[model samples]
Target chain A: MKRRNLLATAAMGLLLASGGAFAQGMDKVKACFVYVGPIGDGGWTFQHHQGALAVQEAYGDKVEIQWQENVPEGADAERVLTQMALGGCNIIFTTSFGYMDATNAIAAKFPDVKFEHATGYKREHPNVSTYNARFYEGRAVQGHIAGKMTKTNKIGYIASFPIPEVIMGINSYYLHAKKANPNVELSIVWAFTWFDPAKEADAAKALIDQGVDVIASHTDSTAPLAEAAKTNGAVIGFGQASDMAIPEYMPTPRVSSIIDNWAPYYVKRVGELMDGTYAQVDSWAGIKEGEVEIGMITDAVPEEVKAEAEAMRDAIAAGTYHPFTGPINKQDGSPWLAEGATAPDGDLLGMNFYVEGIVGDIPQ
Target chain B: MDFGGINPVILIATLMASAVPILLAALGETVVERAGVLNLGVEGMMVIGALGGFIVAVQTGSPVLGFIGGALAGAVLSLIFAALTQVFLANQVATGLALTLFGLGVSSLGGQGYNGIKPPPTEQLLPDALADLPVVGPIFFGHDWVVYFSIAMTAVLWWVLKATRVGLIIRAVGESHEAAHALGYKVNRIRLMCIAFGGAMAGMGGAYVSLARVPQWVDGITAGAGWIALAIVVFASWRPWRVLIGAYLFGGITVLQLNLQVAGSVIPVEYLSMAPYLITILVLVIMSAGRKANGAPAALGQNFHASR
Candidate 1:
């Protein structure tokens, strides 16, 4: 027993030495990912898996990539994260807003295992990091197009959750739509899930029945476009998380899309680990960093509207204009930003209110 | 025409469409339970049906044929459960759960390369002229054939179960299989046939989601509708007409909740969000405590083995 104790101590010392070495230069890096939806979802999870695949292509044999899909964000995530950490995942990326707490909790347990959480702002431990794409930037583009094209002036948003990330998208989309057309009315139905195709379809159908001609969804699925297809040119919608440019609904219901581009950030972080320059970082990149892209504006949009939307996109990409630029007000008519004043990062990160002129309370 | 921004006609129309899937699934379960079997694999069978229906619809370019293919797929999958619980004398509950896991595995494996593909549009049965008539037209007409078929099935199921000789044999086998065996009735054989009917119905219900409602293939597309169907069976006390009422009640509240939110009603979204589950639980509890629950098959969930 005494010899076993001594041997265990010696093994612990060796592990610590290797962990220290791992903190520095490493010959090989194993990057793992946990996704909230199936990779075949053709939307959010599909795109994140694409980013994981990009890491493999970028580093080849130097990096080993592993991923688990359809991981629900809660205790299940903690279990999966702990397993991956014990399995020697050098850096684990939890790719969903709901995983904020689990990522931080698991990060604390495994101080040597680096953690990167997407679209969340909880970095309780030094080993945990947070990164997110400014998806609202893409929403701004879709809103402008939705506002310009809707004949009914009634638009709808199928919200996944009441989280700040989704709330921010709602406000941005509605703000831009309200700016383009003062008469536009935005209807929101919280489906309360990230990727249930059947529920998403019901929400979209509800909106269509209520005469909403322009639709946008915060959830991950193409069923919204499929439901929009049933309208046969009456209603139109934009693809969320992926360029749903499928031949079935393209140029019609899927007039445009917001593609989440995580490859650059993913490849960059994996490369940083390889070069011994890794540090806990908070990244919030948008169109400028190529993290958020507006998919092609189909010919269905009027030429002038398409051109104007493209101009806004370029301005956003060039850092000359902010999507949440001034003259904005809280839902109750309280002033949020003065004219010529853009929203600060702090306010957008924890946004919880609907902008003015968009009626209805945000579900708490 | 509107109550709290919800057009009653349109709300009812959407409710009918939404309820059809669960209605069909629950209706099938009603038959299975009456025949003295409880297969909890409705979810498994439904998802496989979704995949089968979507693939066939996309391949053959015929939505009608797609539903048939879905039924065939679900029936084939349920046969595994039927064989296990009936012939092999496995525990119905455990095998049903395993069947769900197996179906999920088979679907994800089979669903490769079918993502993002849309099935052909399901044709609405009625003429547009009839469908365009105000209130009544939108509320009662213009749905795909499944809606009418489900309602027809409900009525037919009620008639057959309450008044027919075949229904008597199934119930006899369910109430006392030993007595059924003494009467020279093939107990396991009758249960097998009933399980197949349940599977075929569940498959069609699942096909409705992929072929008409969502009209696209996604892994696990049924998403617990089968479990809800099981719950509805308990809620309805295994009766056909009550299953319809239970399905529509759940469906109505589901559609109304979203419409209420869209209308920006004074009701809280959080409360509305929980309303469906609350009502379902409330009904299930009330029915189980009531006298109607005496309708349960005496020999439900039991395996039959031949004896001297």
Candidate 2:
């Protein structure tokens, strides 16, 4: 029995060595995904799952997709990635910022396998690639509409942790809102959580009680929108990761949304892998690349305001407008960008401070 | 710097609403521990309750029936732990942990078709006159029925434990199952009942979170609230009234920190976010230090076998 097992292992190893041509002349590619939250989270993970489904839909039987949901972003992620690599998965996508270290560590061990980490920065191994969407671009559009629609001139932001990614979104949203309406005052409530609905709702309620008429969030849930709906047109919110404009609360609470369109990128990368042309590239695509999309700006906004927001979206897509173009100053009144100077990608990627108008310090 | 818009009444009202879920779960845990069973599956039971309550609330269009469904779901999940530890003589702690894992998986599975769905609205229990009372009106009278029910359950549990025979028998069994057994009481039977009660309360707590607080269903909707309830039980020192206080204290800190952030307070937001957990630990340490005896039941976590 031991000899027979060893013989079977040898045969499998031979099959793996002969790249496209096997004894049966069939080649198949297995792609696996690791999600930080369950696919039913309705915000972040749910959208990523849709992208994985798109990959299957694009390739038919030539590609196989497997995903393990709710994989925590620590040691457990490493174990899951390792198991997927051992199970003959040719490529794996670790989809969260927290999986940065785990993806790199696992990628080192599985040199022949390709690893993709989303919303992360590190690429310690040659086989590891990182990709992220410019969610701030969508934030810019939401801010434009928020500034115009808020009757109280007070826009509340429900933030999730003080990471650079979240901070960047906050600053972009605040800046655009300030531009659209200089009278807008931004109020931020840092919930320090990615997806706790009750806490998110309480944050929204607190902001609303304090006279915030418009709300924006960098968290992963529809709770803020639901909380806004409770006010009966007195409060409005923008959806964060997905279009959360459910039929019941549509056109009012969720006037617009920032959607993470990962399908095209996922499909393109998988195509590259199938053709043996995949490379370790740092891809940060945004509006122009069709990675980050702005959901419909419903009739809740006035026609002129909607037109302005649409123009900004078109300008962003046409590469004529940059969200960070400014004579902007730091929160402490230090010079950040000169007049009409566009802030570089490096500054935006490592953004940790709020722009001048935003109150309070970014928690270290 | 800008604290002008912060209203004390609204702040306190939000605090009460936030505290109800934890208070209910802690009160249930208080009873279960008083009867000598240490069930670590509160989180599991809570998630199942959240999903179960959400499903029923959506189908029936009644928040009341939704909460009942949540309690029932929680109780049923707890029965698995009771059978494992009480009937089959399994390790209580291990079985409880397994129950939590099972609950999370099953609840997520049950929640598949229910994502992005909103539950029926829960109305304020008090009339406008009472609910609109200056300062105290919003704080004390503007919550849904579950908020009042949680406090009432604490009071009722306190009365029963202090003045009732059933409470004495349950405490006796918790203190020493062998002695309770020699006294001709059914140890496992009483424990089974306590477990079911704990499960029901936890389910209601979870249901309150999904059906009332957020009014929507998402995966892992309970989101570590059950564990907070467990910590609150310990922080309460196994007393019902203290559990109420502990739950509110945590809730108040949570609401206050968010208020501080919105007011542009100078304190770091991370420190503000960590304040509740730190305060809970400090309170627990001080309470444990001041008390001469540990508040835990004598036979807590010890599986009782009839022959042994």
Candidate 3:
């Protein structure tokens, strides 16, 4: 069966070569996105949808955008990707880490169709390209702010899952917070959910009750901010995937936010497809590449603290500083990086341990 | 008392608030099952209620009227199930499942513009003086109006079920619809009222979540809360007061688990995540294994025909 499939792929490649449709660029490209959560979630999936919209606006008539929201990340993803591929999708973007395997499986089946998987490292097929933002860079900025802004000397993280993406963010947040405040204590609350507002609210309340004045959540909802809003001014938090610096929680609960700017990446990839320059690339861009942005810092932060945080942000964007620089130790107190050395991309992508000071298991 | 930073007062208060949605929803399902009808679409009614309540709250800027609108919307949707099962004599289980799917889809469709919109805060029923009375103040008095309303509903439902003739008649119809019909009571009519009542309760529960708890509109906002409510009804053995206990136990465990995780306890937080459902399952085993408890209404989920 494998031999037959390989022969079929070869024949299709030969036919495509003879037809020479994509030899230069094509006039029109249909870009598709599959989201893991509802676009109304106001966070991760919403930001991705914003990126999809930017692709449409970038090329008015040259690109046709199609998307399916709340597509679960297992067998269902494979079926959706297969449907999109069969429906003549020029390029399909699977916008969740859980969809990695499904994306590659479908990409293998449809060798002619290009596949892009976000925040995932697996690219078993050449048509598949992996892209992720160095969110820890933004985490460094937020953590620095969290450490500086806390009145209780304790901060909390309402983490969604134990994935590397979330782990690295926590590590960077704690490390930066500790740097800003020598006596800072970090509390971690694992909610183990992506989008349940009630549970997320409970997580936030738990932290607030613990006297953790600064809260950070990896879950995709405004519940954390809403909970912080109830605290009046005792608790402050940062927006997760999107800029949640809305009026209700603004300048107080939401001191700042880390906005995931996928517009540049989306438009660039789709443009490459149209311009016949698209190829497999493992792109991991951050603040420097404008894929990760520090949202507008509100006036709630003290002047000097805000200036320091901005300087750190500038350093990250300028590629002169790394959030996971050396002088770091694993949770067990073994040195992971030497002084003056930065974390390698491979280590960051596969991060599974807490940096020394964070007090809790990763729920392996 | 603070046990490893797990404050008893805050934990109880948070549990009461979090449990209100499930408590109200389970109470509604208990009433429906007692009336000899099994409406498995509580989740659907609740989500529709969430959307309806959120829309009304956003439009009128009144959390009270928004709750009423949510209840009304749930009643209107359940009337479709009532008409299908009670009137048309369709399969109750299938119709109920279909209602859930329909509710989720329609609410998401209706919820296009309501995203990220926070409803007006539901105010506390008691004064700040009463709420600031230390441990008792926060635990018993600091909660908003819906928490009190949920407790009142449990009492009212219990009175209407255990003592009153209205409760007796409803149970008579539930236990033996044919006998009730022979004695000149309209079983379907009684069930129609009960089903609508159930939907309103479920809808109000959904509204409480949107307007009071989460206070934002998201598609499928009720999540699987309705199913949990259904499980509680079975676990409660169709008793109203037991449903209240079951709901609080579930809600308390959820709150407790979060607190425990924050305290960095020795208990595996991963296991704690599933503890609530695990207890529900355990209670279900005990209830079914030991037959001394009150069981489901015999006429539950049955179609009634006057001629037959």
Candidate 4:
């Protein structure tokens, strides 16, 4: 089979070299990835690269993936996109918020190319689409674990900006923790960036000094985990992206992680292209869709706590429960949603009000 | 009316701290410009410093040593600009831009391994009691030593530029490099030293963000702060005291807007996020309004050739 595939590839290569244009309807799937950070950064971009590698291994000659990491947020983003487009990338995935305007602009310029931007709202042309994993849903599980495991009743949340996305994660985590253990209190610190290991660590230290036991961060670094590990046996953290594990620096992140399964999506798109049904899509997948997965429960987690967390996870998957179901109150004790009124997707995405269990202002 | 809610005191403090990166870059540029040389490679020098300080601090476990490492890295990176502008007599602006592009790539590669790791803890200098004092506490006492030194450097710079004989020589060099060259001042040497110094300070400012403020190893961590600082120098009309005001104002806008977002105000966080940069641009536009707004040295961008 391998020999036959190689021969076919050789034939195709020869035909293409002769400029004969062999087969119709997507002869090759030219895919590109744009990273906000360096691929070797051992964080967010690393994980995305892992997914890209998985696709390359799976598809072989059928797929050609090219990636440019550390492309800045503005005009540079447009330049990289144009370069990728001119290089014959049929599908380009830009992975940053600052890349939103640039991606849209480039997508308009190259009408045939499919542009997918992660965590951006402005999706214009039929060629452009937006996709984001339900990271907040996973944060709920992390909060649940923190609530059950923390003896101090104080869980520290290191956030990246006060944007609705980060705010939503903070609220979801707090809501779940508050549900599991009523005494659980949240100590939040906004680090103001997607990646800054030092500030993330300092925020962790500052929270620990103030008597918080568990640490959670939305920033794209393992600084919180490393900081948590230094405290002998007390502190614990969950992996942010599935890529957070740096074995030499720290042990496994205790709670589960939210993994982005771009493979299935990528593969499906490639399949569509092969069948002449390729189209742009704005996809937001959660636990129900398997994009967000809960990993092995670490030994640091107590048995009872693990059982409760597993139950919650199961309920979420079964559609019998939601992390942000109602009867919740704002931090100021005002009723946010009446009983049984699950917070809608719109509210979740534009979350401005904090729930009852949190301390400190969202800060104007 | 609601200036109290805006927390002007905290705003001012943040602005001052924010100005450090710009002040460092500007001070170095001030010297270079004073010597009739324009080294526009501030951004490159800064990024090199960002990685250098981050790597050293992580390795040495000392923020002070990390800062020194940052300055050295800046100086090293500046030599590229120095070589191009001085020896090759390349177009200063174009060469500086190339330095930035090259620095971005080199620093990304140099900083690869250091990414996603937590920075070593920084030690605060002020005594706990003093650090806790009211409005003055955070503004005056709570900053790391670098903040104080930045302020002190501004004063020293003002004195050097206006009150000293050496200042006269530097000013003379900027005004007429040919004349300074005829008067036997080592034209290229002085400009080289000033360019290197500017690079070092810019690097130190970059280090402060990585080591003191944000203190993380992220790609493009300087995040256009170098450009903003460059603009601040012009906005301040090249005055040392005004540099402090400009830096603090920009910083204050950044911190206040973030604070407002956290406070759950009605304003969109996006606007707040962009407010500082937009304000800086606006300030620059306003500063350039009057005729004779070119407060800069007449020979700022001109190359000084010993033979010419």
| Clash pairs, model 2 backbone | none
What docking grade applies to model 2? medium
Scored by lDDT, model 4 comes in at 0.75
Each model's DockQ score? 0.69, 0.72, 0.62, 0.10
Cα lDDT tens digits for candidate 3, A197-304: 888888999888888899999988888888888877889999989998677777888999999999999999999988899999999999998999988899889999
Candidate 2 chain A TM is 0.93
Worst 10 residues of 4 chain A by lDDT: A15-24
How well docked is model 3, in DockQ terms? 0.62
- Rank list by DockQ: 2, 1, 3, 4
lDDT of 4 by residue, A1-364 (tens): 6999999987675445323112335767877899987665555777778778877887799889999977878999999999887677778889877798999999998777778898777788888888777778788888898888788887888777676778888998988888788988777766667764544555565566556788887877666666676676577787777645445334434455555556666666666765677666777778888777776676667788888888888888888988888898888999988999888777876788788867666644
| Clashing residue pairs in candidate 1 (N, C-alpha, C atoms within 3 angstroms) | none
lDDT of 3 by residue, B181-280 (tens): 9999999999999999999999999998888888788776786899999999988888888888888889998989899988888888789898988886
Worst 10 residues of 3 chain A by lDDT: A14-23
Per-residue alpha-carbon lDDT of candidate 1 for residues A1-364, written as tens digits (9 for 90 to 100): 6999999987786576338435577788889999998887889988999999999999999999999887888999999999898777889999999899999988888888889999999999988899999999989988999899999999999998898899999999998898899899999999888988888998998899888999999999898899999888899999899888888887888999999989999999999888999899999999898999999988889999999899999999999999998898899999999999999999999999988888888888
Off by over 4 Å in 1: A1-23, B292-295
Which candidate leads the pack in lDDT?
Answer: 3
TM accuracy, model 4: 0.77
Q: Judged by TM-score, which candidate is best?
A: 2
Q: Could you tell which candidate, 3 or 4, scores higher by DockQ?
A: 3
For all predicted structures, in order, the TM-scores are 0.95, 0.96, 0.93, 0.77
Q: Against the unseen true structure, what C-alpha lDDT does each candidate score?
A: 0.89, 0.88, 0.90, 0.75
- For candidate 1, the per-residue lDDT at A294 reads 91
Q: Model 4, B1-308: lDDT tens per residue?
A: 23523455655555565557767777766677766777777888888898999899899888888999999999999988898898889998899889888887889879877766656756557987887888888778877788888889889988998899888888888888888889899878878887888889889988887776665676767767778777777777677776776776776666566455334456655676678778866875576678584578878888867876
